[model samples]
Target: MEFFSQSLAEALSMILSMDQKLYAIIWLSLYVSFFATLFAAILGVPAGFGLAVASFKGKRAVITLVNTLLALPTVVIGLFAYAFLSRSGSLGFLGWLYTPKAIIIGQVILILPWVISLTLTAVSRIDLRYRRTALTLGATAFFASLAVLREARFGILAAVIAAFGRAIAEIGIAMMLGGNIKGFTRTMTTAMALEHNKGEFVLAVALGLVLLLVSLGMNILLQLAQGRYGERV
Candidate 1:
């Protein structure tokens, strides 16, 4: 009991004193998560929107595949990325292994299914009338789709927030792809794991606190988005 209390106190002190290394880990975590979410959103949003509005064969199969990928383990993604980025692997010439870029790639693959699946659900929930009304008013197909997208904006935002949360909290990809390099690719989750393994509780506890706070913030944003959408409805 006494040990835990002392460790907690030291962790709080480190956080309050704004330790550079601690902040560096937090920053790298956010940076990688932000870019991964960005790329995933850019690609997933269009694909999801198409799935919601378009009529095509095998659509159910594609959606089922995406849903299945949403449950893919972080370690599996890390290993998959490692296979392509390792020195003897096919795309290894770019030398991205054990770097921030490598971590970002792994994280992107980890959360892409979340973005796409959530986006499809969001767009699917919108009434068909939204699109029909826009098209009936002589709007072009592109503009009509935009109208529906505008209506589903809040739900899509929630999806993005959720994806960022997933990317930030994952440890496997960062550890395997980034190699947990201090002051470089090290992230909050990876740093916490390393610190814990080294029998250092202060830094690990501090990073855990920061990770919880980030998660809380994401949940708050999601609730706000859902609330705003509810108000409109």
Candidate 2:
């Protein structure tokens, strides 16, 4: 108990004092996660929107595949990325292994399915009237789809928030791809693991607190957005 208390106090102090290493780790984690989320959003949103609106052969199979990918383990993604990025791998000429780019690649793979699946669900739930109404009013097919998307904005936002949470919290991709290089690729999760392994608890504890706060903040935002969406509906 005494050891725990002492470690907690030090951890709090490290956070309050604005420790540079701690901040650096936090920044890298957010940096990697933000880009991963952004890239995933850019591709996933359109793919999901199209999946929801378009009718075609094999559509159900495609959605089933995407849904299956949602449960893909992070380490699997890391290993998959590692193969292509490694020295002897096909794309090894790029020398991206053990870098932020590598981690971002793995993280994007981790969250893309989440964004796509959730966004598809959100858009699928929208009333058919929205698209029909827009089209009847002479809106182009593209514009009509946009109109429907606007109505499902809140759900999409929730999907994005959830993807960001997943990206920031994952450890396997960060550790395997980034190699936990300090001041470069070391992220919150990787740093925490390293600190704990070294029998140092202060930084790890501090990162845990920050991670919890980030997750809490995201959930609060999701709830608020959902509540507002309910009211709007």
TM-score of each: 0.97, 0.97
lDDT of 1 by residue, 1-233 (tens): 99989988998999999999889888989999999999999988988899888889999999999999999999999898999999999989999998899999998898888989988988988997889988999999999999888988998999999999999999999999999888888999888888889999999999998899999999999999988876665
Which lDDT tens digits does candidate 2 get at residues 1-233?
99999999999999999999999999999999999999999999999998998899999999999999999999999999999999999989999999999999999999999999989988888987889888998999989988888999998998999999999999999999999999999999999999999999999999999999999999999888778766656
Model 2 / residue 157 / CA error / Å: 0.4
- For model 1 the local lDDT of residue 58 reads 97
> Model 2 residue 99 lDDT?
95
Can you tell me which runs of candidate 1 are displaced by over 4 Å?
none
Off by over 4 Å in 2: none
**lDDT of all predictions:** 0.91, 0.93
Q: What clash pairs does model 2 have?
A: none
